[model samples]
Target: GPQGPRHLRPLLDTVLDALHTGTHARGGPLPTGGPDTVTAAVHDAAGDLLPDRGDPDALRTLVHAFAAGAADPAHPLCAAHLHCPPLAVAAAADLAASALNPSLDSWDQAPAASALETLLTRTLARETGHTDGLVTTGGTEANQLALLLARETHGTVRLVHGANAHHSLPRAAWLLGLPDPVVVPAPAGTLDPVALDDALTRLPGPRGSVLVAATAGTTDTGLIDPLPDIAARCTAHGARLHIDAAYGGALLFSDHHRAKLTGLDAAHTITLDLHKLGWQPVPAGLLTVRDAHDLAALHHRTDYLNADDDTEAGLPDLLGRSLRTTRRPDVLKLAVTLKTLGRTGLGALVDQVCAHAREFADLVHDDPRFHLHDRPAISTVLFRPAHAPDPAVAAVRRHLLTTGRAVLGRARADGRLWLKATLLNPATRPDDLRALLTLVHRTHAEGPR
Candidate 1:
């Protein structure tokens, strides 16, 4: 089904048009839109058929059409997920990687690409003060790799974590062959050492104690767990402590927020994603382990492919250490972004984003119509209608999506919906969030449901 030799001009034109005309110059559109209208517009944009006539021009047209239909998270007002307004340098690197079409499974296929990945992985591990790690596609894969490593090395069954750990942790368990992983509850989205101890007592400890996952920054509430305390308890209980810092690990360079990750050195493993807080393009996540020998368990091999002895020749294959075989060179973009932006630039950006998040929380603190759920720990503000009952959360969410005002965040805990805003753009001004708050007020007042 491969299309043979085609001119690259059309593809180039398509990509450029999507980047320029399809995306928002500032912030993206609001999350909610009329489903009927959205689908109708997209249908009209296409050539009125599911299967297009195999024309290159038509395909290019389809590309722009799809881009136009998708929401642009790069927009300034897009504070929904842990999405960043990707750096221009990183975006260029991504385009280069796609052009190269390198498969990182072996050195013969990807020589320089493999070497670049190796250096980037090592650099990231060093950044985490660790000796070994791999570049995963994203945080979910990194977390899965971390869990698999723990299971293979420690040989335990039970996993413990704060109640507010990202959904990926439980999903990681499911993917790694442990369907019923233990979930240890901690109050206020922060882990209580005593609660973990009690959990240890209730569950058969030492036998099933596989891994203890701690959050440096939780996804929904942006609260950091008592990591040092959790690490200490993990050591006392002989459990491998893995810090899921995917959302907060970028703070390592930020002078303002580094204190939040004070005890990260004590963790056995750490996961950080450049695509999230680091403001790099997607498909870059680092899983750094404290020890190199511990990572040997995940080194898979097969006779079908010849292993490269490049480490001896000053070039090592990164493919062996990763969970993915036909992997994309996700590291190049990070390396380029880091080199171009420098540590200070990125640190300042992080500070700017967090400052805006704090400003948002403060702005909503006493607003009679809205309630600030918790303080902005890193770069997120959890808020909802102050007067609206907890039951109205779902209705409000549905209504927001129906009107296409903003792409807001939604979380459900104990049967209550909590709305969150994850700030990643340094250009997102306080006034922009203020406008969102105004939109929320207007939307709530006009609720006909």
Candidate 2:
């Protein structure tokens, strides 16, 4: 079981060398290859792996090659999604977590890791003004868990969310065997409270048992819904409110913008994704509930793992806190990040990125060739070229990606395709965004390829 440092030293050197090369020497955000090209390279790299073991040098070379091919989020032009360039310290913490490989199912398996998760979850809950919660894989799982708890508590109920809600909500409803959700329209990015009230009035029978899923930050427009109004409406209708703040929950850390999520504390449950805005790696989602009893719906005892008697005997188990059985303690990285950065440091980073989004929106508004969709509420600006056709808008995005110059986002707004820039990197400047827009204009002038 004892392994020598000689065995690990080479592996570490290989990985570090590859990482430096990939980050510093990469051509652009993405490599110049389509799916077929990359697929062929991957297949060739895997040749004779099972039948004949490859040399360490060859394997290391292949790993570096693959790393080089990945799209670089650290690139300023990689402003497509909520995919932020991970902090180096957080990445290092993640590597430690991977090496330790703590499975958070039982205390015996992960003693300190389980405790760390509890500590992190408790801190998150306090920040969101909740008593208890658990870490999840991402916003999808957090949303599903929130809806699942809502369904279990209220039995048969209809789901309600804005039209601009994430695609995962409908799927979550289906998975929970709930009826089709009543989608309230959000024309200007933010959900209209009048439209929501009208929709609630039109619902069949009593509205006493509805699951009102509110969006804190929409994906396309980065708008926070009218949380106070929505919360009041839910209370009036005797419905439970769940705020899906997967994108904008970082406002909790921002002193300037935390007011945007004012009514968040009133919600019955809230979903937050640290991966998006908290500057952590993927799979760091959190779901907090006002009433701890609501989580009892997901609880089940196991004979070998978390026996009922084990709890009575003073053995603390977290099986009931998760929908999963064998979950990794991804919370470790979050804990390390929070401790290293603190609230003010993280909040400043968020404020900086959001400022960049506003700056970009101003540029779009001032430019004659671009059309500003709306003033961004978060760090995402939705706009398109003034003269390009809807189809050409998508084409321009593809062209940018294919050329490996940029990796911009595309979305449909009001029956038309629009380009999006999710300014998640604090290091990105106004000049960088202006350069991106210039590229978009030049690409549009070339016409759709």
Candidate 3:
């Protein structure tokens, strides 16, 4: 067991070297020649997967290919989706987690990790004004769990979510076999309080028969639902509230922007994802519950793992913490990151990224060649080449993708397609934003080559 480092240290060097060489070889945000070319490169490098004899240099070869083809989020030009370049320390901690390979299904398998997770997750939960929380794979799992718990509390509940809500919420409801959800308008990009209140009142059901899903950070445009108004309506209409704050939840760390999420605590459940704003590696998500008693639904016992005698003898039962069995210790990286940065350090990072978005938006506004969407609610800025047809807007994005010049996303808002730049990199500078705009302008001018 202790000899793991001795064997892993050299392999670490090999991996690091491959990553360095690969990023340079890529030379841009993503690999050139687009998906087909990237596919060919991977096939060539992969060779035979199930060879009779194990290939000794497989690690080095594969790591290089993977990194070379990856759309690097750390690059200033790669501003797309909600992907963030993970912090170095968090990634390093993940390496240790992998080497140890502790599964969280039972305490006996991961005693120390189990204890550590309980402490870390509760502390995170309290930040959301909730009594307890569960570590989840990400936002999707957390959202699903929220719906499941609601259904358990009240049989056959209905989901009422804003049109701006994350797609996962309705999907989770449908997966749980709940009634079809009612959709409210988000005409101004944020959920309308009037529409939500009307929907809740019109739906004929007992109190707590409907679950209202609001969003703090939307996937398409990064807009937030009106939490206070939504929560108040839920209270009045006798409905439960679940806020999917997967994107905006990290604002709690930032003193500057936390005010935007003022009524967050009013919800019965809240979803938080650290991988988006906490700079952690993937699979870092948490769901908080206002009532700890709600978690009793998850309690399950299997004699081989979490035995009854083991629990009575002071062994902690880990089965009640999640819906999944055989989970990896994804908490290690999250713990390492939260401990390293604390509130001020993490808040500073949040502030910087938000500032970067505003700066880029201002740049777009000043230039006559581009049309800027409303200012960023979080760190997402939407803009399009001024007077360009929607087809040209789509083509410009593809042109950048094929040439490997930059990586940007597209979102449909206000009945038009706009190029989306989600600035999550704290290392981004003023020059980087300028350069990004310049690339977009030049690409549009090149006429879809």
* Candidate 1 per-residue lDDT over residues 302-377, each given as its tens digit: 6344444544566445446777678877777888988888889889999998999988988889687887787889
In model 1, what lDDT does residue 278 have?
A: 85
- 2 versus 3: better TM-score goes to: 3
- Each prediction's TM-score versus the true structure: 0.90, 0.96, 0.99
151-233 in candidate 2: lDDT tens per residue? 78878778889888998998999998889899988887777888988877777655447888999988887889999999998
Off-target runs (Cα >4 Å) in candidate 3 are none
Worst 10 residues of 3 by lDDT: 220-229
- The positional error of residue 339 in candidate 1, measured at the CA in angstroms, is 0.7
Q: After superposition, which runs of candidate 2 have C-alpha atoms over 4 Å from their true positions?
A: 1-9, 204-208
- TM-score of model number 2: 0.96
Lowest-sum lDDT 10-residue window in model 1: 23-32
Local distance difference test, per candidate? 0.77, 0.86, 0.93
**Please, what's the RMSD in Å of model 1?**
3.4
lDDT of 3 at 420: 98
